[model samples]
Target: MPSLYSAPVYWNEQQYLLSFYDPFTFRLTISLYIAGISLIPSACSAPGCISNYYPDDRVHIFRVPENPPELKQAWIRALHCDNIDRLKVVNVCIKHFREEDVEYIHKVPNGDGTFTSVPRYKLKLKGGAIPCLLPGCPSYYSSTSTSKRARLSYEPKEKEMLNQTIQLLSKI
Candidate 1:
């Protein structure tokens, strides 16, 4: 029985490492090596995330120049990424977005025994979308907490006015 291994192949003028393991015979074939293959860059766009694989539902792959500026800005604000620089070869993953924010989602399986789903081309993101809480992303939807903090940090003018009225009445 031949052992399973990875091989480097050139496809579409790009280099890819193909993994093959024939479970039936427990051997890899030579014809598989002759086939064309391509590899997608899996680095996620979320800040402080070092993920290099896209198998997770949170990991979304997209092409730049095809994405709108609004979607990019949301990621930039959430991830704190530099919008002016490092725009090339960057991808924003689904982990940074809420389900509603992602307008559309589609995936195609790469038929290489690896059950990884490749994202389709028509993925669209809703405008004014903000990233949800993910690693390194502070949750911005906690309005109640923010309101409490606001109350603790500053007294409302209305409260001060009410206090003054009470003091005047007490003196009278």
Candidate 2:
């Protein structure tokens, strides 16, 4: 029988290992060998699963550019809106940091009151920007504890807001 195991794998052109199991009477193959294969997967967003993205599941970090005004605002809005998840909305806390005129930062404060440090991911937001950095998103919906039981839900405008934001990022 053939099985697959997801282990932390690393490789070079000469030798490589993959997710397939040990072979008692069979062989294995890897998709790529031209380039060194990092032990990690490119990403794990669920192929077409599109539950959006979970904050904690942020196994990898991404950076966004700030040269263009439209894209900058859009990326921040998307992160804030919790549009990463299709199941439910969890508004994010966005903080746009700047050097008076350098750039912006749309931050989702973690338990330690610190923002993620993804290079170039520091973003800027316009005054009108709203955030979706809710307590639970991209995964768990609905409140669990008494402290946060949001009677409110994802609003209508959020759809358009999140779309416009990502579009800006995709372009440049």
Q: In model 1, state the lDDT of residue 69.
A: 52
State, as a TM-score between 0 and 1, how close model 2 is to the true structure.
0.20
Q: Highest TM-score: which candidate?
A: 1
Instruction: Give the per-residue lDDT of model 2 (tens digit) for 24-103.
Output: 52444333333464443233222222121322233332234344545444444434434344523222322222223223
Segments in model 2 whose C-alpha atoms lie over 4 Å from true places: 2-4, 7-15, 20-33, 37-73, 79-172
| Model 1 CA RMSD to the hidden true structure, in angstroms | 15.4
Which candidate has the top score in lDDT? 1
Per-residue lDDT tens digits for candidate 1, residues 8-119, read: 4556444434555656645553432223432334566566665544323234554433355544543455456665355556665666555655656455457775455556
Give the clashing residue pairs of candidate 1, or none: none
Task: Please identify model 1 stretches exceeding 4 Å from their true place.
Answer: 1-38, 52-58, 63-71, 104-123, 137-172
